[model samples]
Target: MHDFDWIYECAVIFYVVSLLGYFIDFLQNNRKANRFAFWLLSIVWVLQIIYFFVTLMQINRFPILTPYEGLYFVSWLIVTLSLLINWFSRIDFFVFFANIIGFIMMSVYVFSPETELLPFITETMTTELFFMHIAMAFLAYAAFTLAFVFSLMYFIQYEILKNKINFRRLGRFGSLPELEKMSLFFTMIGVPLLLISLIWGAIWGHLTLDTFFYFDAKVVTSIIVLMMYSFLLYMKIMKQEHGKKLALINIAAYLFLLINIFLSQSFSTFHWW
Candidate 1:
């Protein structure tokens, strides 16, 4: 195998080890295990960076055209977000779930069937607008995913609070207030990113396809997803909507977004992948 491939495999192994460390920390609340998890994940991130750069050099373009590459990018985004949350808040609970997502993404990428690399710049995908659109869209997706996780955490904590259940046995999960803040933070960030992505996508389509807009399934679904989040944010910030209602809205929006993404290719003419 090539050196980059070896590095990739090693990164995967390190991620697994890091995940185990986090799991142990969750189970036993061990500070050492938490530290180990952070350090191991840092190593994995470094290795992944090296592997990504090597692959970029080989491909001579962004390695995001294939499913495997997309998975890798998503996994990296989740890991990066997890690390940031840990650094800022010393909250490792999010890291546990984020790494679970990262592991699944990496596993899918490793096992998925390989496809031959296309030429460095295919006509349809070569534009700066296209690249911007894809990047912003995926970043928005990652943010929304984090928001979804936080919302789920909020609901769990809310339930515990309502029942007056002891939280001491629940590991390192955040308090309801913390979870609420984080969820709102992610949603606030995600909405603008998604809006920007849509704008770029429209520009790309107009420049390449001679159409400024189309009422395609992907387009319509994306708009719906955007509007739902916008409403959620509006109600939360402007009307002071809180608690179960906000959490449920966030959860429902994220679920709709996921479904839209999964079914988009089947019905949308513009997005095939």
Candidate 2:
């Protein structure tokens, strides 16, 4: 097995550095802070990837059998994708909340000590199709999470403008249109991936649940989360909502997803996490 202790310890340190850099960027309004944060976050992701392969080799299976492992991997992927998007778009504002959430996720994994061995059922289901399904699902969730961060920033700045408050922090950001566009872009990509994930999940569930093809808690919660996004998408397409309202909807949807995901993981009888 890889040295879980060492890798996890390094991951925690890297997250802390990235978190600090992002926080500095938010407060000091320094573009370089974002650059530093992204680099650190990227390094940590690379290390985590190495650690994951080592873990799989040691256990002879994928490292997603536990909620901790699965969530950690998703968090890393979110950071990686955010970095890529920021590089191409040159929009650095979202790094603050992204790193903050990523740091919290890393903390959770660091604190929750667990083995990485796959359960028998997990091993049986780890086919190539299953891998694709889980990767898409997690990436979709990550995109939504990033969009939620942008939305929150948009709302905060929106409120400042509404109140006619002249805050220096708000001055650091680009125009509201700019931030809203980025948030909308992330949500658009995330919604389609979520739809695909739901369909693949249904197929996998049918394959696994031989007896009944009804609703489990995880499935029900996932569907509800999906519907929330669909509602936003519908509104956006109809041109009925824009700007702050759209951002608010994305924030609300992600919050609901977070609650549902955690609750099902905690109490469901058949949660894969």
Among all candidates shown, the one with the greatest lDDT: 1
Worst lDDT window (10 residues) for model 1? Answer: 114-123
Summarize candidate 1's per-residue lDDT along 50-109 as a digit string, tens digits.
888898898677877655677788788888888888988855688887778778878988
lDDT of 1: 0.84
Candidate 2 lDDT over 1-273, as tens digits, reads 245769867877887888788888877877788778878888888888877787778777776656687678777877787778667765566666676787777678777866544567766568776676777778888888888887888898899999999777675555788788877788888888988987887777667766533467777888888898888888888876888888888998998888876777675666657
Candidate 2 overall lDDT versus native: 0.77
- Give the runs in model 2 whose Cα sits over 4 Å from its true position: 1-4, 30-35, 115-119
Q: Each model's TM-score, in the order given?
A: 0.92, 0.89
Candidate 1 pairs with clashing backbones: none
Q: Measured by TM-score, how close is model 2 to the native structure?
A: 0.89
RMSD of 1: 2.1
Number of the top TM-score candidate: 1
